[model samples]
Target: MNIKGAIMRVFPEIPEFDEVDFSQYSTPYAAVLIAFFESGKSGLREFEEFVEKNGGTKADVGRFLISIFQYLLIRYRRYGDEKVEVPAFKVFLTLKGWLNENGFENDYTRLLHSFVGYLVDIAEKIAEKSDCELGLAYMKTAYLLTIEAEETFKEEYFSELKKTAQGMVAEIYRKCGINGGLPEKREKGC
Candidate 1:
């Protein structure tokens, strides 16, 4: 099936899929990720509009998160060279605050756990393909560090989180066989 068909199958109830102009994005997954990030940037008002347009509930948002992660997993598995962009810690804090204020904290927590588990499975697959145990370990460590950073952001521990997240990104870059350590500034589309 096509990308749009796959996305519709994954998220049949999201009306935003119908309204979103996917031509600007190279892939449907990219479109969804951009929408998600845009919603977070807009204090979730856009997300609320998406849900309302689709006649969905907060529970659907949780499902949407899972779908996004699942898409990431698929893309990574199919094209091992694809770099997964880890959002900034501030994005997590904003999303967490929005979930708390909007009464979806529990759902978000559950979905996060599921997402991490999926990452674990993906890491294992990647390891198997590359025949490198250390690579898998690094991938898993990066994922755990990311989760830790997100979890601790509410306590104003962003300095430490930023450091850890940078380390995680470096590890991911290494695992992907990208040479030349973290740049002074990450290039766009990296």
Candidate 2:
């Protein structure tokens, strides 16, 4: 089977994460992620309009976060013990906290668990369907995060094109936390 076929094989039967499957991302899954990540004020019609206006893909304002941060995650194991202040796990933890503060109903553990679980599930699906020896899969995981930033941090998303992904993520975490949602755990790890 091809890579896209592999992606379809692992598609989640559950609505939330299942809709995020890379292949379905062109339609149903894509729309769901857009609605979930975009503003509560946005309607399905509006989302479609945005997509139409943006030339097929949703006009994700924070599109680069996924690409650059993904690099960080893949490289984490190699750098975990090198005394780097922000390992990928830590970055993920921080992102989890941010997700929680943004009302994801999660702490770092739950957030990372959900996120990683989603990724692993997709990877398994892809492996099952595809014959490719190796693939950079998560790059396909773009629509969700950008839609998230577009809704949650419109200014930050549009203000800079070349800022560090680490800084952008940290800033998003802070703002989303301070936006009168759940207070982040004051612990250093949080």
Candidate 3:
């Protein structure tokens, strides 16, 4: 099965929304949504296992995810890349708190720590490269990739996935009201 199939199987009840309204749900729910969009199937599996092992329901998992998302967004807004290292440490502290509260085993906690780190890294990259807002870029990348992967698999059109991904990113930028023009790279000393 494709990534979309994997995601739907893992999160069958995810609500439909054109834009993510973080306020509509608890942090946990929002976190799961972010993870769902950002990390895809593997991220889903990691979250599901963490919850199951710790006797956590989906909401508990969502809360943990949201905490990470909130930390990253706050850091991004405040620092604007000036203090990258500090934000990473702060986010780690947040994840550690959740792991302690949930009584996750040492091994499991380490795995989640890494996963959270990965999610943050990807989000930061998206924010830096795209014209879309950080949150919207996160959502759109995941959404578009899943669709592209599914169609590619069905059509056996494997060669153009890279181009398709690029197109999706550009489309997302346009939708978000960014010019979506490729910035001309300056060549070495004119």
Candidate 4:
């Protein structure tokens, strides 16, 4: 195969946004996404496995996959040429790229197996570079936050979460392709 042909054929399957209704999701989705992203190296596998293991069974998985993509795309924008510079996510991106090169193998639901794999690869590289222990210590903390964030989304007050999360909320909003800047007119509140 020529280089262009090989590139096109390498991963025959590209995820289709077919019926993803992102607008239907509430604010907590963004909150949960921020938590997943904040977890960095410690939570990559947890999120990836959650998406992969539940592939095709749950409706939320598709949303979850796209949420992750948006998160990384924001990372791509935030860090630009340095998205892989983090000591945790380079491992994730590399491994994900490897998996894609191998084949676009997906269980049919989350369509995010590849994306998750890539995140893990980047995380792995970061861990190696930083020499941080990717162990239960951080895992427990990361998941605790994730679970809490998930719950906050299910509550009636879920819409308020984005305003309450401070930096995490802001990052999540940015990742979701929303350019949340200062309000047009300054409010009394800071």
In candidate 3, how many Å is residue 102 off?
Answer: 19
Give stretches of model 2 more than 4 Å off.
1-68, 77-85, 104-111, 114-190
* Candidate 2 global CA lDDT score: 0.33
- The residue-level lDDT of candidate 1 at 120 comes to 43
lDDT (Cα, tens digit) per residue for candidate 4, span 69-143:
454444444555333234223223333343444353242213232233333334333333432233222222222
**Candidate 3 regions with alpha-carbon error over 4 angstroms:** 1-42, 82-190
lDDT of each: 0.46, 0.33, 0.44, 0.34
- Whole-model lDDT, model 1: 0.46
Tens digits of lDDT, candidate 3, 18-127? 12232322343444444444554444446667456556674566455445445445544554543333333334444445555566546334444334334334444555
Off by over 4 Å in 4: 1-57, 81-113, 135-190
| For model 3, the run of ten residues with the poorest summed lDDT | 15-24
Task: Tell how far residue 132 is off in model 1, in angstroms.
Answer: 26
State the lDDT at 183 in candidate 2: 21
**Model 1 residue-pair collision total:** 0
Model 1, position 95, has a per-residue lDDT of 44
lDDT of 4: 0.34
Residues 66-151, model 2: lDDT tens digits: 32234444433343322211223333433444445544443433333334433333333433343333211221222233333334
How many residue pairs collide in each prediction? 0, 1, 2, 17
> Sorted by lDDT, highest first, which candidate order results?
1, 3, 4, 2
